[model samples]
Target: MDFFHGQDSLSILEWTLRAAVTFIFVIFTVKIMGQRAISQLRLLDFVIALMLGNIIAHPLSDQRIGLKGSVVATIVIIVLYLIGVFLSLKWPRLRKAINSTPFPLIKEGEILYKGLKRARLSIDDLLAELRKEKIEDVKKVALALWESDGEISFFLDPQFEAITPSFYQLQTEPFDLPQTIIREGRIDLSVLRKIGKEEEWLTHTLRSLHHTEVNNILLATIDSQNNMKVFLYV
Candidate 1:
């Protein structure tokens, strides 16, 4: 059975086998590449993505192209990509070259037209980005940087910033993440136990405070204070 190096005319079963093996190979390759490879597409990452797509796609579409050759080429490319990533981490110059340093788009509430040109962003693009950040006035921005990941980081001027608890040195309780006890009209016994509460306790609390059955509640959560909140299905 010709599986990897397909014949001139491939059988449907052979084609299916090739596709399945390719799919599994792609999945494992993606797994090998950590989260950053998926999330952030830097220069190196972009090159790797393009190369892999082109290499894998040709063999799958054309029976004349051997599947085994594509797989071998992909393996070599992946190895080279890993080496580039490792070298980028060790060398600052290479790192900067691969993922360029942040360019200052705005300073002291003034837009840098040269920065915009260098970043290859038009005035309309800048305006659209500002609108997305909900800043009506450019003067309100103290600094705005064009990051390597094609995202802009904005900093509001001190006068335009909101007053926070830290500004007044106010005391605040530690933030507590509420644990889910019930979801989709089903009670989670493990979560209930983790919160140090019994199933009977949950039943009794729901019946007394909310006057609702466990099955009727769509979602429920409890905080550190044992304060249970319930949401019923609409």
Candidate 2:
């Protein structure tokens, strides 16, 4: 009893051994489960991970439970996880039931309130995701799907998408994509250099626009068309 309560050599060694074994087991299990198990975890995979964490923690903290029992428990979890993966692959209905279907957040630039409610997401949340995709207006999106992994995939309307030179049967020189040179009043020197521009050139341009300081600019970018767009602080 005293040995279990105290931080003695035997107790330390036992805890260390338990943690090592548990870590190795978890690593191998994850390796066998493949990248999808950790990257794009579905509901069943998420639940199994949570349960496995608790099961592993029990033996690590409890001095009474031995390593053999912990190993057996972990193996059982792995087997169940494999079975779940098999079922999900073999049966479409079971897969849909386990992972759920992608929710249609936006269609034809219209927000689906019912889908938002079902996904437990608010209008603001969807707006934030849209902003992350560089979309200023939802009207530009033809379709938006809320994936099971909680990621929003956007499909832009053909009218809102950029037209290629080939569409007009015109030959154009190769150009680099637009990169932000300044964001929120901070000058990105690396981006400036990447675009074949210098700090001196940027400063001169700002002077021409009646702007003296880089800190006074809110946003600035140069497009493939060699056009410099600038937004000043209000």
Best by lDDT: 1
Where in model 1 is the C-alpha error above 4 Å? 1-40
Question: Which pairs clash inside model 2?
Answer: none
What are the TM-scores, per candidate, against the unseen true structure? 0.77, 0.54
Instruction: Estimate candidate 1's alpha-carbon lDDT, on a 0 to 1 scale.
Output: 0.79
Q: Tell me the lDDT of model 1 at 30.
A: 51
Per-residue lDDT of 110-207 in model 2, one digit per residue for the tens? 99999887667789888988999999999999999878665778999999988988889999878667778889989998888777888888889888
Off by over 4 Å in 2: 1-40, 165-234
Residue 152 Cα positional deviation in candidate 1, in Å, after optimal superposition: 0.6
Candidate 1's residue-wise lDDT over 117-147, tens digit each? 7777788888899999999999999999988
Could you tell me the lDDT of residue 224 within candidate 2?
A: 64
Q: How big is the RMSD of model 2?
A: 10.1
